[model samples]
Target: MFRAIGNEELGRGTLGHSLHMLLAEDPDFPSSTRSAVDELMRQSELDCAVRAIIIAVTSAQNPHDELEHVLRSHPALLESEWMCDIRATLREFGCFSLY
Candidate 1:
């Protein structure tokens, strides 16, 4: 069910941290799964950082629109690439929803 995340839960802290720990502490995780889990963790971290900055500046309790606007406004923004990577990795798992 790793591919079943819905809404913004993936980068909202608890879920992401739990997944990272679950994968990291797993003694039997295969190399590919570990790598994918690692990528998910890295991108989740960056996404959380971006979300924090936006919320700090705009004071938006739920800054989904602001985050989307900023990421879509400029292609050069690193958050866009990070978000895309997160989407791609999750998609590879079959049917994950990040939006």
Candidate 2:
């Protein structure tokens, strides 16, 4: 069996949080997509955090809520080695806190 996903459906169905829970048991919706979904979700979170980190690290203005959602959802990201370095660097220069 072959299924073709058109452009509109491709955009609408993948790369974001548009997936529905009911599809979990559907054979057409492969279980292997779980990692893809997690990667996309992490990408979304990373986009927010990276932009916020850039802003906070480069300017006097704090990231404020821009870092909230991602940090809340994936707190471990803060403890990652790179993030620890960023935080440590910022702290040394009296820059902003990412928390």
**Model 2, position 19: C-alpha lDDT score:** 30
Error of 1 at 36 (Å): 7.2
Residue 12: error of model 2 in Å?
36
lDDT (Cα, tens digit) per residue for candidate 2, span 1-99: 001222232223342212323333456443233333345346665433433333334333333333333346567557545456655665566555322
TM-score of each: 0.28, 0.31
How do the residues 5-99 of candidate 1 rate in per-residue lDDT, one tens digit apiece?
Answer: 33254443646445544554655433434244345445664444433322222232233443344445333335445456543543464332222
What is the lDDT, from 0 to 100, of the residue 65 in candidate 2?
37
Which pairs clash in the backbone of model 2? none
lDDT at 69, model 1: 48
**Candidate 1, which ten residues in sequence have the lowest lDDT sum?**
53-62
> Cα deviation in Å at residue 83, candidate 2?
1.7
* CA lDDT, every model vs. true structure: 0.41, 0.39
Over 4 Å off in model 1, which ranges?
28-99
